[model samples]
Target: STSSPSSSSTSVETPVETLKSYLSELLNNHNAKRALHGVSDLVWDEEVYQYAKSFADAYSCPADGMLSHSDGSYGENLAAGFSSAASVVDAWYEEIQYYNFNNPGFSMATGHFTQLVWASTDKLGCAYKDCNTIYGRYVVCNYSPPGNVIGHFAANV
Candidate 1:
């Protein structure tokens, strides 16, 4: 039998990879499935949808032009990304707070993920009447951005 040193050591997953897997599993859970179905069934108030459309229209990309989807086919992907990122953020909110208080400058470099989530979900919140309450609570209470992180890029511009 041939044994290599590599085989003796256990593989270690990075925090990011572990978080990604956790988020993936969360989306596959029954509650997430139920929420998704509920979302599909809910209707958006036309006026709200129009307002959201206008907001999206007025929004411009930054110098790097990230999250720019000209044809608007990016909505679903954005939603998925936002949901995943939100899940991870939600799970780590306590730890994030500890880090923020204990280590002021500590950043996980998940800024892009947070930005993507905020941008996508903010639009959804505007467009979906049913989502407004939950989204409001999530943004205001559950998933507040860290002090150094910008919640919305367009807002900063």
Candidate 2:
């Protein structure tokens, strides 16, 4: 392996864009779909759907954007990619914090991850939380087994 670790900023930006562009494309199809089974497509609520859509739109990118899609089944490949990229970025954020705090006079860290967590599920349409750090920062992450493991290890390491 190359001794020099890849810069997280380079990796993080693409996912943010991929997610934003994908969502922006999906939202273009404005017809509301039923929130529940057998509820009838006729019962689709425009206000509710648009509200969720707008929430996704206005929310910050990369960090919180991935959380919004946490609940859904994101197929295999895409989910894997998301998990890997997030792990890398989260680790980078923490490392920067440690380096900055320890090397106070010589080092300064800028660029903060936004504080917004949104996890949607069958029971919960969109659960929102904040991933903020008093001394550092956090990205809102969907709590899944292997995926979450990557996050936990990154933080701990």
Q: Largest lDDT belongs to which candidate? A: 1
- The numbered model that scores best in TM-score is 1
After TM-score superposition, what is the CA distance of residue 7 in candidate 2 from its true location, in Å?
Answer: 18
Clashes of 2: 0
Candidate 2 residue spans exceeding 4 A from truth:
1-39, 63-65, 68-157
On residues 22-124, what C-alpha lDDT tens digit does candidate 2 reach at each position? 4333222111221211221121234333444344334443543343333333100111122333442343244334443232222223211111110121111
TM-score (all chains, Cα) for each model: 0.22, 0.20
lDDT of 1: 0.30
What is the C-alpha lDDT profile of model 1 across 1-157, one tens digit per residue? Answer: 8888655432222376663454344333313322432322122234433544444434332223233322332222112123444453344332333333233332444332322233223222121111222221111111112122443333321
Report lDDT (Cα) of residue 74, candidate 1: 23
lDDT of each: 0.30, 0.26
Model 2 Cα shift for residue 24 (angstroms): 14
